[model samples]
Target: MAQQYTKKMIRQVFVQMLNKRPLNKITVKDIAEACEINRNTFYYYYTDVYVLLSEIFQTELQIVIDKYNETLSWEESFIVAAKFAVDNKTAVYHVYNSMQRETLVNYIYNVAGNVMIRFVENVSEGIPASEEDRKLIASFYQCALTEMVLRWIAAGMKEDPDTVIRRIGQLFAGNIEASLRHSAALHDS
Candidate 1:
C-alpha cells in the first residue's frame, strides 16, 4: 500500500509537470523536485521519464477498460474516457504534442480495439461469431475510432465531448449490429 501511494505521488507530480511543459523538456530532476523525493526514489519506481509516461498511459487505459468492462456500452464508456481527456486537456495536449506521441497513439489503438471487441461481443451475445470475424470487425471499428479521436486531438480538441461522442455514436449505431448479423449469416452458410 505504501508503494502504491508513492507511485501515485510520483505519477501525480509527473502529470503536474507535464501540464506545465513538454515531456522532453521535463527531466527526472524536475519530477523529483516536484514530488519532493530524491532522484533515486523516482528511479526506484520508474526507469526514466519515458517509462513513467508509458505507465501513466497504461494506468489510464486500464481505468477506461475497467469502466467499459462493467457497463459494456461503448457509448457510455467512450464518453467517460473522452471526458477524461477533455478535463485534462493540458496534460493530454502536452503528451499529444510531445515526442512521446507514438506512445499515446499505441495506447489509443489498444483501448479502441478493446472497447470495440467488448461492444461487438455484448451486441452479439447469443450469436455465434467466429473469433476471426470478431477480430476483423473489432479492428475495423477500432481504426475508425482511433483515427477520429486522434484527429480531434490534433485539432486542439476544440469540439465538445458530447458532439464528438454523438457524431461517433451516429456513425457506428447500426454498423455493429449489421456486422454481427453478417458474420452470423456467413457462419450459418
Candidate 2:
C-alpha cells in the first residue's frame, strides 16, 4: 500500500513538473524534491525519466484500450481517447517538441488504431467482409485518423474534438459498410 502511494506520488509530481517544462529540463532531482523523496528513491522506483514516461504512455493506452475495446461508438471512443491530449496540452506539447516526439506520435497512432479496429469490427458485424478486408478497412481509417490527429497536435490542438470527430464521421459515415460490401462482393466473385 505504501509502495503504491509512493509510486503514485512520484507520477503526480513528474507530470506536474512536465506540465511546467520540457521533459529534457526535468531531472530525477526535481521529481525527488517535488515528491519529497530522494534521488535514490526515485531511481528505486524508476530506472530513468524515459521509463517513467513510457509507463505513463502504456497506462494511458491500456486505459483507453480497455475502456473502448468493446465500445461500438467510434466517435465517442475517439473523443474520449483524445481527452488526455486536450487536457494535458502542456505536457503533450513539451514532449511533442522534444526528441521524444516519436513516442507521442506512436501513442496517438496506437489509440487511433485500436479505435478504428474495434469500430470496423462492429460495423462489419453483419457483413460478409473477410477478415483481411475488415483489417484493411480498419488500417485505412486508422491511418487517416492518425494523420488528422498528428496534424491537430502539430497545429497546437486549437480545434474542438467534437468538430473534428464529426467531420471525420461525416466524411466516412457510410464508407465502412460500403467498403465492406464491396470487399464481400469481390470475395464472392
Candidate 3:
C-alpha cells in the first residue's frame, strides 16, 4: 500500500503552488514536485485540483462554525468566516481567478447558506417558517454573501474583510429578519 499523506502536507503543498501560479497553471505534477511526492501520491489524496480547492474552503468554514459558542451573534460568526477568507487571500485569489472559480463560488455559497440557515433558525426558533420559506431565506443569504465575497476578491481584496462584514451586518440587520418573516407569511397566505 502507498504511504498515507496527512492533510497538512497536502495543504502546505497546495498553498505553496497557489502562491506562485494560477490554479489552472497548477498541475498535479507541480503539487507533487513542490511537496516532494509523486503525482500518484497527490492523486491518492485528491482526485483533482477542484476537489482540493473545495476541501480547503470547507475546512476553514468548519473551523469558523466550530469557533462559535452559540452565544455570539451571526455577525460575529460571519466575521470569523470572512476573516478566514481574507487571511487566505492569496490562495483565494488564485482559485478565484482560475477555471475553477465557478466551483469555488458554489462551495462558498453553500458554506454561507449553511451559516445563515443556522443563524436564521436560531433567531426564529419559535417562529413558524415552512421548509420552503426556510430554504428561501437560506438561499438569499447564501447568494448575497457569495456575491459580496466574489466581488470583494475581484476588487483585489483590498478592503478589510471585517469592515465589509460589519457593513453587511449593518445593511442587513433588521431587513433580513423582516424579509424572512414576510416571505414566510406570504407563503402561508
Expressed as tens digits, the lDDT of each residue in 71-183 for candidate 1 is 55787777766766777787888889988899988888888887888888887787787779888998998898899889989998898977777777887688887887888
State which candidate, 1 or 2, has the greater TM-score. 2
The TM-score of predicted model 2 comes to 0.94
Ranking by TM-score: 2, 1, 3
**TM-score for each predicted model, relative to the true structure:** 0.93, 0.94, 0.84
RMSD of 1: 1.6
- Stretches of candidate 3 exceeding 4 Å from the true structure: 1-5, 180-189
What lDDT does each candidate get?
Answer: 0.84, 0.87, 0.77
* After superposition, candidate 1 runs with Cα above 4 Å error: none
Kindly indicate the candidate among 2 and 3 with the higher TM-score: 2
lDDT of 1: 0.84
Clashing pairs in 1: none
Candidate 3 achieves a global lDDT of 0.77
Candidate 3 C-alpha lDDT tens digits along 1-189:
234345568777887778777888888888777778788878887899778887887787788778865686667877777775666678788888887888678767866876888887776666676767777787788888889888989999999878778887887787657866786688679
lDDT of 2 at 54: 80
List, in order, the clash count of every candidate structure.
0, 0, 0
